[model samples]
Target chain A: MTSDTALSVVFGDKISDEINDRVNSLADSLKKSGIKGITELCPSYCSLTISYEPDIISVNRLKRKINGILRKEMSVRSEDSVLWEIPVCYGGKYGEDLDDTAKLLGITPQELIKRHSQTVYKIYMLGFLPGFAYLGGMDSSIAAPRLSSPRKRIPAGSVGIGGQQTGIYPMSSPGGWRLIGTTPVDVYNLKREEPILYSAGDYLRFIPVSEEEFESIKLQIESGTYTYKSDEAVRK
Target chain B: MIEILRAGPLMTIQDGGRKGFADKGVSQSGVLDNRSMNIVNILLGNRKDEAVIEMTMAGGDFEFQNETFFALGGADMGAQLNGAECRLYTVYRADKGDKLTMGYAQKGCHGYIGFSGGIDVPVVMGSKSTNIRCGFGGFEGRKLAAGDVVSTGAPVSGITDNSYSPETENTDEIRVLLCAQNYMFTQKGIDDFLSCEYAVSANYDRMGCRLEGTAVEAVNGMDIISDAIAFGAIQISSDGMPIVMLADRQTIGGYAKIGAVISTDIPAFVQHKPGEKIHFRAVTLKEAHKLYRKEQKFLRKLSEKCQKGR
Candidate 1:
């Protein structure tokens, strides 16, 4: 955002772990710096656009403060990243596009599920709709084109593939993603203080479940007795 | 309290909007016309961030449940009270059982209704703005519907004689600061962008406004690493048309943007309805900041005058 709003700061140009780390580190530093007038910060793949109160702090002075922070040796903060195991039911009514997507990708329904559930994805960033995490590391074999026309309401927890990427729709939204499964968990529970389930730097692995199991999990969640299964993991 | 007798197509509770939640992908969904929202708020002597009812195109009927002071602003929607004419941009009293009705807007796209205090609604994620897409915040995380009842807080101050009439501009030209993947556009395309006229398409909302105009050729291609989006960013899609991102814009996007509309002009810019003509002008970062500071000063002075009864 440097040449743009005089409020945004771009760390790099492309998507790489090194660049993203720098972007995240800079955002963390800004948050802890107690730099007054900083209102909001949107961290993207390789850039950070900060929204601040113009009346409280001038752009020139804010730029000076950022420059001062950049000079310091920064570290990527990911020690506390959690590894969440998400359960999904991968066929029938839960996944409307499963049969069509498997046919388009030249794979059997079982094979599609196997490939999708095997990969542990890294939550690169949270964006689009609330709790919608843009995950990396989708298998090329499972890739499929998006719908020609987006549906008006894709239900929350529908796992879908769009091009070479895949993600979960934490809430109902109009989208073109090809749905392959449905998760029983409410990844974005508005009733809770923090609506979003996973933050950037967290890792999540999908576990295929039977439709019966999905119903059981759904019931448990409704009863508020389902505990989120997660494990401690070191940043690689 | 006020009961909505007829809720229009798009009526939502909005304030100054939330901050510091961009990391969770929440959009800054606030009032589209801040200038008018401020005008009504000032006339009623409410906090600048007080929540108000934002109506699009047509303002539906509202029945007063109690006696209170209220003001109207933004595009005049031909407001009437109890079958009589009701003025806009002025604070007026409404008695119990009074019904306020507004026909379609004759001037601007959005119309704002402000109370003496502010709409009493629980603030979620730090703001009262309704994020309709994400489905949270504001009044029950949704738009106001017919039969919906809303309450207002105690009046912070009394109404005054001070009034505001915005200095109208004849031209529809909007200034943009070219940055963030702007280099992808060719010099000739940039020239065409500055000189060309665009028509606002019917497909418009709080999310964005699409324009029908000359294609802005992107020599480096339209694809870019997804990056954070500003409120007024003009993203040139693969088809070459520019979409002006607005209050309900996504946190980040991958499309290449020519530039962002300066902050001061967003209110005036959003007032242009569908099929309206639009022009572009280039400005430096310094120039945009200077203009922003001037608007800030004007608002501050107006707020002080409204409070001091000057």
Candidate 2:
């Protein structure tokens, strides 16, 4: 599609598992093509935006190259996807809005936590902030709306629900999502080589934990000894 | 080296920007006015991607710790070097202990100050531009403050005392390319967006420029599935006010975008201050590309001339 300096290739008009998979596979193929002048490839829920240097390659030529690549069939292997199990502490000072959110959903705090942790969620994309993943797949029973008024600061590692989706905040910032829990793991670390923990095709599962367990995990993370659990068998 | 005596408003070190990081949710945070920043760097005979100090509105006091050449571009901030008035788009020699001071801008919103060898800052994530939101690049990923000491590399040799100024053109109408979601807005809404003059809102920042004018409401609503956003994407919020995303914009957005500002006109748009009125003119993608190629040719010729002067 027409844009200022980039060409946006939209796979679908809505967010779905098939659309996300197509977008991811297309991004992989484009990266493998070794196309020159492509400065950045940004993938979202249903589209991939290619930013390139106009001086190196004209837009028409780039479009033709991409179209030629798209004609070939490509598939992402299941082993390439990683599923991370993140430990979260719910219902305390860290999750101040947990009770209110449960009340709105007409469920107890324990039930809400159980339902949230039971299902695995897929990361649609990373945006809003660094390392912050836009996740999909939440139980309709615990679906809740965002706060009417946004808080000035939402602490890092906060797990919140907005509309029908749930996600975590990699860093502290202003937000309006209803907080349900907090994770002890560092989803984003600037000192790390990759910085961000999850990618577009990654999966995340929330595991409920106690306050003591959360503190212990935090200590291990700070001491540089914590290891994240990943399941590589899960395929989309 | 240079010591900041008074850091006024917001000042940050920036280069061309951190590219190839949008997938990780990182924005291309760089100078707001690309043309002006490039002009200052070219005038100082520095590399195109050399880091420079970007001052917003007003400039601060800086004491030169070493002898070097410096150039000013973009907004006219009423700069003075050791009690002598300095002209815009011209390079000047600064000796040790010379204090450079700049007042508030007479016009425009941002200014660029470039040294002969450029400012010295560690490159993080493949760039020296400060990602203020993430707090990781360009001088500890924060704005310049008083008492901060910044260093510079050795100046380039064989540079003559020559300067070039770009022709001043009054920019009131900016060109925009209709995007994929242009159909989301009604025909009347699209007409209103192009016909009306919108005033730059006071809530504008490096991330985006919010406009206050006739609300261009979508036929259904402004909600859309989150999609990739680019620099100069005009996203109409739920309230119907359009916000033009900038260099420091988020990589993705959920609002519907009617169009994107053309690259050739982005420099002029970014230099506008709050309360400034501007109109949008729709141009075909082919025309926009032609204009971009013409601008690049001019810049290449200018660089060649500067090299000859050296």
Candidate 3:
């Protein structure tokens, strides 16, 4: 369904691997088409919003162009997607709300961490803030609701959970999610050619680490010696 | 170099804005009233995308260390160059050590000041516009303040005495094109939205302009899958108040958008002050496109005239 000016191509009503892959494939083709007047192509969980200039191309003409591209049936390129293993320290000062969140879920802090790190999550989209990835795939048993009152400042690299979704805070900002852990890696560094570490459709696996390991990794990152591992194989 | 003596509220350097970054969740932060910004740049024969200082309701005081040609546009902010009254949409030469001061806006909310050679700021993500929320782009990724000196690019020739004054229209009527989610609103809701008069709420800013009026409730709920937001998206909050998203709005929003105000009319809409009554009128997409093309034609002719005045 498209707006009068912007075109929003929705794949399905639910969030599924098939839908995400289709969305990614469609986005890739539209980008490869090199359509003129397209200012931005914002891809979310199940839809892609194409913001274009009406002066350069009328909305009806652009829609027809997009429809023609869709009819060509592009396949998702697995090479474009990457799988990352992020290290996290899930307790103590780094995760201020871990114990409270675990108690609310009727589970021990260790159990909560185990459940969170065990699942391979998918990066549904990046929104709310710059480089903040909206992640999917979390154990329903450990689902936690957001805080009634949001914090004034949640530190950067904080892994949090709100409702059924789990994500990492790329930058320090006010948030209502319950913080469960912190990552030493800089997921959003503006100095890099690609500011965001991950893109939509990328897979993420959290690996539990100790506070001492977190500090050591933080030092390694500051020294520019830390490098993240990426696997080309896409997990089903 | 121009040094800020008194940086007024919410002053920032802006250009055409950082495009192609919305996919990464970056807002396209730029001048609120782009028409005014373009006119100021055109008057000085500066590049269309040259960065200019966007002043809000209250303007500021600055001292130039060198001679440079400058132009002012948009709101009548009572600008004075070296203690002499300066007019909007007119080019003026400022001598070394000249002090330029401006008072509160007399009519509209935004005012623009353009230098002969755009304001020199490092382009981040391909834009000089400031996104204060993300703290990147524009002068150090923030608003201008006291004691800050800003550089200017090399001046271009062919600066003319060309002046443009946009024809003032009825500010109360804002034209909108129905969006994809128009079916979500009941007929009564749609009628109420078009018929009722809305006042600009006090809680308006570069991000969005909130309007206080009769609730335009959706037949269905207001929640929807998050989608990209355009410059003039009219999103209805859960409370049913309409918020016209602007340049500094987030790249995407979850609220159901009823429609979008046409691009050509956005300049006049932004100039409106809080507590001012505004009404909406529906226009077909074709009509909206025609208005946009007409404005582009006028701007092209104006640019040509300025170039010929060398």
Candidate 4:
């Protein structure tokens, strides 16, 4: 709809090229206003969420203040890339739904894996759970919808694709995403000084590692000695 | 310490609630009637955020295993200590082995029982609240049942005072802030939402209350992406019936939230039992903010009066 409706709603309308101009600028404007009551400022794919003290600024007033900031033009940066190579083991016990997804797309499991790792995905948002990144730019050939009924529990670091989105389960919790592989990355570690392994806007590449390497990385991650490698590779 | 002889429906142990763990998918599950719970805690002179017992529908019988002070608030559940009318909003001293009992609620659904010190349940995820969803926090992460023994951390410094005051049971109406998704419905749907009296369905619990009301039309192919949801958020299900989520609401939801009840009006809703008919009215955000501040001021003054009068 219009910016009027988007200004008031907490979950604004989906991101579009038209609103992209406004979305790109709102971040800088918020910082410039010197607004004081907020505890956190988290920007996502299209919307920005500001958590404020209820005693200071009422919810309604906060909405109005944010709308004022939206009017300003923000500096847009196009060239930004931080490649993260995540080690994944595809089509095994960790990915129980791999065969089903491959059958749905009329392709072999190995072919599905090839297509999945072929494209570099963009971290669109991080909202479901802590460190659970919603990656965009998936290969549409392997695109699939989420499970009709969500599984009771999906293990942490279980990589799954739902519709055009692909993400790793940050924690062992109930989810409906279609699992294709398991990552050795500790996406969220509560005990660690810096919990979230990957922040939003980072590019990710899946490097298919063997089961033995997966186990070795898991122990290293658990023992607090896992050193992630970030090698650059141009799109081929 | 007190021993539960008989507990009513959905009695649970509660405290300040689990916070700062939302990233872990755990919701803050504290007392539903936070204001009343705070009042009872103030009367007992315990830590305002200390764990207490929250009973629903009807209260139960208990025996004071130790000589200590306790208080009751929230619902007008006629309570008795040694068969005598036990007044609320004031601390009462019960001797060791003294039997105390409570009758069916006359006004509200949930009530609070606060001891001088506090219920000393092991904390889980930085709270003593009993989250039934994940079976975490409070008395081994479960509901209070018959023959359950609830102990306190330490006795609070308070004496029995006849100067206790009670709350005026108010069920006028619930105030709400219209949500953004409200426009998804038609004008008639909005009118029906504010005018039609909804009955609290029997399917009520700490998670949410499924309401039975006028059947509104659910727009065809209307899909809502998962978003953050708070307590007292009225989410319209696919069937167009309203469901008011409570303290144990999920962190995020995919349903269309028509409106969120004003924060201060939560206690009023919590006091309502199943089958109770209540009407909702939309108020300007300005009015909501003013009312919230006014309520806070009134509570502070009332509490001060209670302390001085005692």
DockQ of 2: 0.67
Regions of candidate 1 where Cα sits further than 4 Å from its true position: A2-6, A96-111, A147-152, A210-213, B160-162
- What ordering of candidates by DockQ runs from best to worst? 2, 3, 1, 4
Query: Which one wins on DockQ?
Result: 2
Candidate 2 lDDT by residue in tens digits, B247-297: 899999889999999988999998889999999999988898888888889
Tens-digit lDDT track for model 1 on B1-310? 9999999889999998777778888788998878788778878888776899999988999999988788888888999989888777877788899999998989989999999878999888789999987778888889999999999877655464656776768649888888757789999888988899999899899989999999998897898888778888989989999999988988889898888888777887888999999899989877887887887798788888787883
Please list the C-alpha lDDT of all candidates, in the order they appear.
0.85, 0.88, 0.86, 0.73
Ten-residue stretch with the least lDDT total in model 4 chain B: B155-164
Global CA lDDT of candidate 2, please? 0.88
Score residue B214 of candidate 2 by CA lDDT: 96
The sequence of per-residue lDDT tens digits that candidate 3 reaches over residues B94-157 is 8789999999999899999999988998888888999898888899989999999999766667
Q: Indicate the TM-score of model 2.
A: 0.95
When summed lDDT is taken over every stretch of 10 residues in candidate 2 chain B, the lowest stretch is B157-166
**Winner of 1 and 4 under DockQ:** 1
- Cα error, candidate 1, residue A25 (Å): 2.0
lDDT of 1 by residue, A1-236 (tens): 53234366777777777777677778888888999888877788878778776667888889899899889886455655688899999989999999999998888999999999998887778898877888877888888999999999999999999999899998888899999999999998867777687777678899999999999999999998998888876454
- Specify the poorest-scoring 10-residue window by lDDT in model 3 chain A: A1-10
RMSD of 4: 5.0
Computed on C-alphas against the true complex, the DockQ of each candidate is 0.55, 0.67, 0.57, 0.15
Best by lDDT: 2
Per-residue error (Å), model 2, residue A145: 2.3
Fraction of native A-B contacts kept, per candidate: 0.64, 0.69, 0.47, 0.03
